[model samples]
Target chain A: MNSYYEASARERLRLLLDPGTFHEFLPPSERVASPHLLQLDTPAAFDDGIIVGKGLLDGRAVLAAAQEGGFMGGAVGEVHGAKLVGLLERARDERPAAVLLLVESGGVRLHEANAGLIGVSEIMRAVLALRSAGVPVIVLDGGQFGCFGGMGIVARLCDAIVMSEEGRLGLSGPEVIETTCGVEEFDSRDRALVWRTVGGKHRYLLGEADALVADDAAAFRQAAIDLLDTKPDLSLEALTAEHERLGGRLERFGACRDALDIWSALGIAAPEKLPLLEADAFRAAVAGKRA
Target chain B: MEKLIYEFDGGAPVKATQGPAIVGVVGSGNLEVLVEPENLGGRCVVEILTAARGFGDIWKAVLEDFFARHKLADLRISINDVGATPAVVSLRLDQAVESFLGGAS
Candidate 1:
């Protein structure tokens, strides 16, 4: 299987979209690199570590963006965040069939600290605005960097999310949590514990992610195509319902420390076995128990 | 960060019919190469912005080896490097050239 987790941003976009249909905006030839990195004596990427463009997904016009995880942990710098915001703003105007964000970021670049934070905020607003404009925003998270920090919040703000078992999503990353809360609270080096806590499987079971896919590109493609029609309801009633749902989730699972505990509380038999199951089997096992 | 420029005489100008091609990523121990077609009077110019300071001699050696192998000309090669070894740099240069020549995508 061609793992989506292992593919670069460009490779993932190429594999996810129709062949020869991706037209990049501000490509490397444009030489639109970050000026902050150079002043800080840091290396800068040509495309600013994010590739945003228009592409055809199942022959449907769509705006897409992918973050290069190998570059500075896919941090959102000024240019990187601007590229995505520009895409979403364009989507708002063009009203494409869908907008796909293959997010693989640890979020805000420390080099451009304030600019990166402002960029993330702008991206959040743009995504929400696009959704309010009736454009379906879909997030595909399966890369090794996963999504953390501000990017994690951006992913959740989308209309729908498709994640692979290898992918993880959370506000604060494992290392951050360990650093701020102590290793006794969250061990960053314990890969298994980290995955179990924030992995795609857990997110899907928690209803945080709409679809749970395998790590292969084909699986992500199929899942993205399937979710192209999902338009989130941003109405007052919908917002109230969402608020209630989240409050209920906190009330029910706030005390749960680990995902296994949450799974057990959801009444799934042999909760430990849930992690061992493949995507298909895991979905089947938690079909009725998902929150 | 250090900016280095090297220009070399070449056998023939490269016929980059397919616009411009880029490869590699600016990551730890890796670099990105952007090869653009230009009219340089049968000369190849390589410009690099590298994070590893005080490696001008090593970079010169690597680019010399690359120009020797490819003999490319009339091309503007730009590289963003982050402490990549000579082997990886050479490999990315060849990959960039191959992509520029439409041999690989």
Candidate 2:
């Protein structure tokens, strides 16, 4: 297709897997749409804005799901969230080569607040269960909407995350931050500042995202293929190492006001120029400095 | 919060359909319709749970119009609505029927 980052959920699924290997479950035609949005006079999509299915990634059996960012900001509602839980649960049972989640959500749909929240928690539980079962869950956050709220935490809990420079990952959105903490604290209109705070590059530097790849379908597919063969042990030793790593981050830059300060603190010679560099160049610059 | 239940008669049984099918989302100004095959003896049953109250008459009129247009029968249509307009409700009903008939799949 065009660019993976700009493609729709179905297109992303097609591009990520080998051609003609994608088989959708509860596809839009099935009309398993949400029953809640209609009561409130809101338009709804046929597939509840999520496409879940089984596909082949480089000839390996894989289960994949992608969110539709254009539909309700890719918010996770009851059916959308349930589809993810079902997919992950199936992965745990089937032990697919990997479970790929093309996450582009803004967390729970506020309309169905309670149900959405419960669904997200269920997804987190399913992700943990799949991980414990030795099934890898790979998350790809490359959509313009990014991944935020409970979805951000879900992405972090995954085995691996592949993000693009154009993508963002965080708990709260920029607008929410600005609304909660005055403009002086966080100017939501400042695009650069917002991206610097939670963009892919920043998350990669913080060791939150595993791989930073080009915003292309081929690039993302290649990155996933490269990582599918290696399964990182989530043993106590690994958990301890990860705990220390995150603890060190908090100790070092938890008090830092600006993202540039964190970059400079990490020995990135020029923090301002970091965002302008290409993915490869950016990786090289922060290769040794990344925690 | 409004709870409305409307049962309509004089409709043919839904054909070429099996099992349950759902469509739409319960977002602001939106709603969802779930169509499940039931032995209602040629009657179409509709249950509406909405956040907007005092619209039972409007819901009745809209649902009556939908039932008149489709040959839906022996089905249970459960709706969870926020404040969807008549047009959206009609559309979701049609979508639910289409899906019930194995059109989308």
Clashes of each: 0, 38
Error of 1 at A173 (Å): 0.8
lDDT (CA) per prediction: 0.92, 0.86
Candidate 2, residues A232-285, lDDT tens digits: the string is 467999899999998999999999998999999998999999999999999998
Question: Which tens-of-lDDT digit does each residue in B1-105 have in candidate 1?
Answer: 889999999557765566788899999999999999888898899999998889999999999998888898898999999999999999999999988898334
TM-scores of chain B, in order? 0.93, 0.92
User: Scoring each candidate complex against the real one, what DockQ results?
Assistant: 0.93, 0.07
What interface RMSD does every candidate have? 0.5, 6.7
In terms of DockQ, the best-performing candidate is 1
Q: Ten consecutive residues with minimal summed lDDT in candidate 2 chain A?
A: A37-46
* Candidate 1 lDDT over residue span A132-164, tens digit each: 899989999999999999999999999999999
lDDT of 2 by residue, B1-105 (tens): 667999998888766447676666655677777788789988889988787889988998998889888857788888877688889999999988887787432
Interface RMSD of 2: 6.7
